[model samples]
Target: MPASPDRLPLALYRAAQVRALDARLIAAGTPGFELMQRAAQAAWRALRRRWPQAGELCVLAGRGNNAGDGYLIALLAQRAGWRVRVLAVGDPAQLVGDAARAHAEARAGRVRIEPWSECAPLSGVLVDALLGTGLSGPVREPFAQAIRLINASGLPVLAVDIPSGLCADSGRVLGEAVRAELTVTFVGLKLGLFSLDGPDRCGALRFADLQGAAPLPAGEPPAAWRLAGERLPTLAARPRNVHKGQLGHALVVGGDTGFGGAALLAAESALRGGAGLVSLATREEHVAAALARRPEVMARGVRSANQIQELAATADVLVLGPGCGQGAWARSLLGGLGALDKPQVWDADALNLLAAGALAAPRGRWLATPHPGEAARLLGCSTAEVQADRAAAALELARCLNAVVVLKGLGSLIASPDGTLHLCDHGHPAMAGAGLGDVLAGLLGALLAQGLEPEAAARLGVWLHARAGERLGGAGRGLAAADLIEDIRHLLEEHSPCLN
Candidate 1:
């Protein structure tokens, strides 16, 4: 099958930044009203494409320009000989400037307009042009009720700009938000649309720059970038005479007692991820099982932290903390690696130990992968707080830990200590299984062992891991973590070929 076109832009902005872009456009040449008209036209086109058979449109309008887009879309539907009605959720009389003009145009165009009430009947397609990105707090009173009505209507809803009651800076839902089947956003893409709860509420998203043939206005740098296929870092093709020693060795440490499988999974992934030599130093009990499962991996039985310290001296990178318990054994292993300067990828129990003050946070070129819960612990806050503003939490963790931090969850964020951030909007709900984090840590270790910088290795490893899950996620449920390893290897080759 042919590849899908890249509808999503890489550059993502905060709500304020997008508004600034709009102002710059107006300052340069385009009139505010013309821009509003263009937005409506674009939305109308998308709506028609999404539901061509639906001949009726019920528009819920507010007092802002977002509602103005609804009014213009109503006019477009009316002109097209389709039945249309504008439910004035925000008093139309309160509209001003270009919004007022839009309402007047709809009125002149003979579109039926009425005040929105709790008992208002809804039918056909619903256009949610309510709060947009102007929501400063939780949804209040009548608008909240209106959003509830729209969500309960069981009608196909198209949200203009952004869904109401969602924070444009963070993806947190503010009290209530309209659940739309399609969202047509304009000017610039907002970062919130791809983070946290934004993906669930926004549904299918479509972006229109509205600049048309005009060059994109350079306002401010992007807040963060979306990791995609284009402009990715690639591994150089190997030389014909290269030997096994040329590639780096990666050591996997963890898996105490009952948790033996976790460390083995990491080691298996490291070998698959192209590490020249992979070693697993775990509890003596797991060595036989590890060798049985994967003979290629050099599995060693280690009883204490001293054993791992010896292994670390020859390893290029260490993939630490998968199934590493919080007992004294786990503590000893963590403490032993503290003085080592080897690059590392810390996940699972390693993070818990660090958060609990078991050892000072490791320095040097290292990467930390923490789920929202782990992130909250590291920040000394609640998980709810971390989820509320994930971008902020990730950056803060990166700064404090002095290492690249990967906040893994719905939208995985890779934040570098230098203040750079990247968001991976790939992966699927089916990937909500166990062992995925262990696989990711090992992949990062393999990439690091191959000589990529901490941040670059993290970015590439995350993309590869998530893309593998997405490819296999089509089977829906029962997605095992080990299933992603082979697919990741294949994808790595496709992205960065082995040979010229």
Candidate 2:
């Protein structure tokens, strides 16, 4: 059986890396054609299981091995007494090597093959084999139109290998992409399948290693790691004698005006996320509400950035910019923290301040939680550019800022300055409401306060926060940011018990 999405491997490779591994497998005795045949068989099995009642199959065949896999599937469906047709998008005559052989075999099996056109009618389970990872630039001409047709068909589309036109390395849609109901990918799990546009395009992912799950060669490390069970980095279980003092303190700064809820949420999240002590330094107006909301937090009202000095002196880790507005007061608060080399989680308007050049970037140990918009500002590019290749944007941001970065969005990515990247594909769309980023920032700060390294904290914090959101977001929309705080606290305990 192919690996289900939830049961996928932790290691994530780029398209080039997976290809290299495929070559290695071929060099180690498995023929390329045999691998293609296995891919087809895996895809066929998954399709039958997913859509058992659907007896008809339409294969959109390209010119590469992806097409070879589709042709073989068509033959299998025909043999199984199901009506099957192959739409040769890339001319079958242009097929080479293994693909050519597969085409000939399909023809010998009496499978109907016809040239593709925009007018072609699509039905049943549409198999997308039009483009694969080899796609270099924007999809052009007939292929793009074919992808559009597949998307508009309202059919149960099953993409072989990957959804056509989705970049195998970046999850970026190249002009157009197939919206597959189920995608059967082979060999290694591509990083793109779990980042950016990948989750939306490749629905219900299934992985087939094709008996090539051998260890990768040296000097070809995975592009990133997927945050999941067993492999997810976590904090150690607390000792029986552990005390609040040993748990560490986290200070949250922000809540300019009319945004007091953001600061309170962060403070509350920090307390619930296992920080022994959490402080909130915000505008005087918000302090009364902050105290009323979270009595345990040491909420203080400060007029100037200098007032934060005493509070910063006590915090082991700081969460900067939850509801911080882009005003002079916000600037002063950020500037005031520059002298202290505290581990910090920078989010919201704090990121804006850094991007706008209102203040110098914070030095020392800091982690950035930037949604695509903030990331674009930091990169000096448009949000579309950042979304186009989130993995690249995350790495660049980490490298440029000299800090761990959590590029928040669909598939939240955590990237470290040393090129280490991890992705959490656990979030929900219902988490679209405000203050979620603030909660994430607070959770990250709590992890940091508790002594996890910046990268480790980022990976664990993102995973926990996303998982909590996923659990609570099952009821659909209207998931408040405060809703995740208690769930995250419970999950943190479940992940690392307070007394183990």
Candidate 3:
């Protein structure tokens, strides 16, 4: 696929939807057979480019047009003098329409077609052509066995469009889905390709518009947005005339007793992220430590809610629950602040509190950053349910909470109450260490205080957090939470809109 900026993004579709698209294209002018040939050529081009030295392609063929694409690819590879073989998982004689023609073409090109055997010589790249998007229930018998073999084969397997047995719309593996080394998709990008199990399954993605010698007409709008640095802009440089108050004050809430470090991290992140004033309302015990750590922050020892209410009253935004415990004390303080109508970000134990059914989402403009377990609590379901389809779960959280929901994970999904989705694919696994979510919540609160809309704030904050994590990747291991704020501040300067 040629890289182009104007191409339409992908939509998650069922096998039926893609078929409908193909039928529409055929009725519009192109023939069905021609489309099949185009899809085959596209897959072949991608395969060769990725595995330039590897030869002798073994295509796993099944029934339907997906199998037809495999056959055609085999023919194309043979023409290029690469030894190619097709192992039929289904009856080749039973194939009808365009697929039958493709099989005949492969035979003419001297491509060997044989019954699939567990002992078949595994060589070069394995092309998974067995199951196309029509799959519903878990993968059964033959296909399941085939998928297991493909995964264990250790060859660079290229899936035709979607990997066998993976749901095209949800990205869930039905029983099991082939983990492809590279996935070459045609027409629109699949929504499933960017979320849930999709990211891990679809290794490196490439797109091919077989119908377009140039570019296809802008198809249906993308089902979800793929957030990238190029699409989002950062904070503008302040004018010399600007004052501290004009920049916005952000309050860091929660640091009960032994957990003061979390609150201090949030305050420091807000300060580094451009909040005009950063206030830390934590336990009296940790006040001195916070002040000593970050002298710029207005760290205070709040014995009761009374002491912090004044700071909360004046705050432009509140970053709540970084290290909040679900104890009675934490609940009491949060209960008092719940109706303050401030643009607040709730994370960690605050999310757990909401999940425990103690506090509810506030009416104020808010951002809720929840990892899978916390999300499951708030939604009253198991974590596995949320991971099964992250896109839907995030959107549901946004609508139910009436706040921007940043469901944090591999491909962090930011969902708005209005149904807009932003997928963030940038982040390192080292970010899996503690306090990362706290850093994110603080960054989000900082953005809201700086005057971005809830959606914009959530989107850009996540990008900043992820980009910062990526920055730490070179250090190798032990990604401590406190290490990110300076890097995030640097990234903000690097990505600032006016600078660009």
Per-candidate RMSD vs. true structure?
2.2, 1.9, 2.8
lDDT values for all models: 0.90, 0.89, 0.83
lDDT of 1 at 98: 94
Q: Give the best candidate by lDDT.
A: 1
Number of the predicted model whose TM-score against the real structure is largest = 1
Residue by residue across 1-500, what tens digits does model 1's lDDT show? Answer: 01124667787878887887788788788999999999999999999999999999999999999999999999999999899999998998899999999999999999999999999899999999999886769998789999999999899999999999889878889999998899999987888888988999899999888963333455447788888766667788888898767889999999999999999899999999999999998899998999999999999988777787889888889888998888898898778685678899999999999999997676678999999999999999999999988888999999999999999987899999878889999999999988999999999999988888899898899999999999999999999999999999999999988888
1 or 2, which is superior by TM-score? 1
- What would the per-residue lDDT of candidate 2 be over residues 411-484, giving only the tens digit for each residue? 78999998988888798989999889989999989999999989989888998899999999899999999999
For model 3 the local lDDT of residue 497 reads: 38
CA shift of 391, model 3, Å: 0.9
Q: State every prediction's TM-score relative to the real structure.
A: 0.97, 0.96, 0.93
lDDT of 3: 0.83
Name every residue pair that clashes in candidate 1.
Answer: none
* Candidate 3: residue 268 Cα off by (Å): 1.1
**Per-residue alpha-carbon lDDT of model 3 for 61-180, expressed as tens digits?**
988888999999998988988888899988899899999999999998889899988878778889999888777789987878888999998889999888888887667888989999
Instruction: Report how far off residue 359 is in candidate 3 (Å).
Output: 1.4
lDDT-wise, the better of 1 and 3 is: 1
